[model samples]
Target: MTGTSPKHDVFHAIADPTRRRLLHLLVDREMPVTVISSHFPMSRTAVSKHLRILSDAGLVKERKVGRETRYRLEPEPLLELKRWLAFYDRFWDNRLSVLKHLVEADDANEPETAVKPIKPQAMDPLSLD
Candidate 1:
């Protein structure tokens, strides 16, 4: 392993918008750096740097073909992220369901009323009435 810090997590790899788009582009099929660079306005070198981060995070796999390097999406690592998000999804769903139930129950107990206007108080500071 290189002397790089072990700060390369899947979350960190996908944190950048460019890197996320790169993953989306490679989702269907493997593509070479040149083709992938065409989808973005950045330089090929910048795209390569993003790919390197994804590679380090295990979100992508690189294969060398003749004179070019191809990259493919490695989605297994993202399953961990999906599972993490799904847990919170369930938590929020349960909480929201309970909230809905409470609101509906409260509405059922209260009767609907027409709007009422308050009459002005006849108090005069000067006449003491």
Candidate 2:
């Protein structure tokens, strides 16, 4: 079977710091390009390019409002990412649980070491220089 489209994968879109910031900006509410660009240090055109990548990835949706285009987060694509991470999380959890049990069992089987008393050594008698 063929693999999924590169553009639709959430990982590729979120790899860039700028794109991740853009997604965070859109989280609370939808915003126009001008408003979103204001939050970033880059040019408005650069912001638009990032937004276009987000749109292609299915992570954001765009709506034309008269002469301007507004963008909002489209979270459905992120569900796949969540599921992928959750699978690994469970895998690591199980491995860690097994490791903990092994350590506890080893501790139970080992004999405890008794604390030894420190004996002060007597000073050696020697001729004074």
Candidate 3:
């Protein structure tokens, strides 16, 4: 696929814990499937399947090194995920600001001694009186 979009979206590919771990493993350097598979408890085939999904999402790139294929992380696709999460950050910030304003307004109307402290009472468990 020269200029076509990826078959899998970054969110879908990263939704699985296994796939996320695969991305982390390939982040620093490229390694053959054998080396990558050794890091996980699953079979080499299983690890290959996870790698395939990541590749489809454009999160990782594979290269032919002699007779073996090596994979490395391509982090450009993760920008989409980061952008999506940033929107929620701004949303929560605005919501928290409104909540803080409402709480301060209510506190200002209350008297300083409005809150009364409760005294602890000791009781005897076996007392009949």
Which candidate ranks first by lDDT, i.e. highest?
3
| CA shift of 103, model 1, Å | 4.9
TM-score of each: 0.73, 0.71, 0.74
lDDT of 3 at 28: 86
lDDT of 3 by residue, 47-100 (tens): 999999999999999999899999999999999999999989988999999999
- Each candidate: RMSD to true structure? 6.3, 7.9, 4.8
- Give the per-residue Cα lDDT of candidate 1 at 2: 68
Report residue 29 deviation for candidate 1 (angstroms).
Answer: 0.5
Query: Between candidates 2 and 3, which one is better according to lDDT?
Result: 3
State the TM-score for model 2.
0.71
Question: How many residue-pair clashes does candidate 1 contain?
Answer: 0
State the lDDT of candidate 1 residue by residue for 37-119, as single tens digits: 99999999999999999998889999999999999999988997998899899889999999999999998888799758999
lDDT of 2 by residue, 1-129 (tens): 235464546898988999999998899899999999999999999999999999988899999999999999988889988998998998899999999999999999888997589998776678443
In model 1, the runs with Cα more than 4 Å from the true position are: 1-7, 106-129
Which 10 consecutive positions of candidate 3 have the poorest summed lDDT?
Answer: 120-129
Off by over 4 Å in 3: 1-3, 98-129
What's model 1's overall lDDT?
A: 0.93
Model 1: how far residue 96 lies from native, Å: 1.9
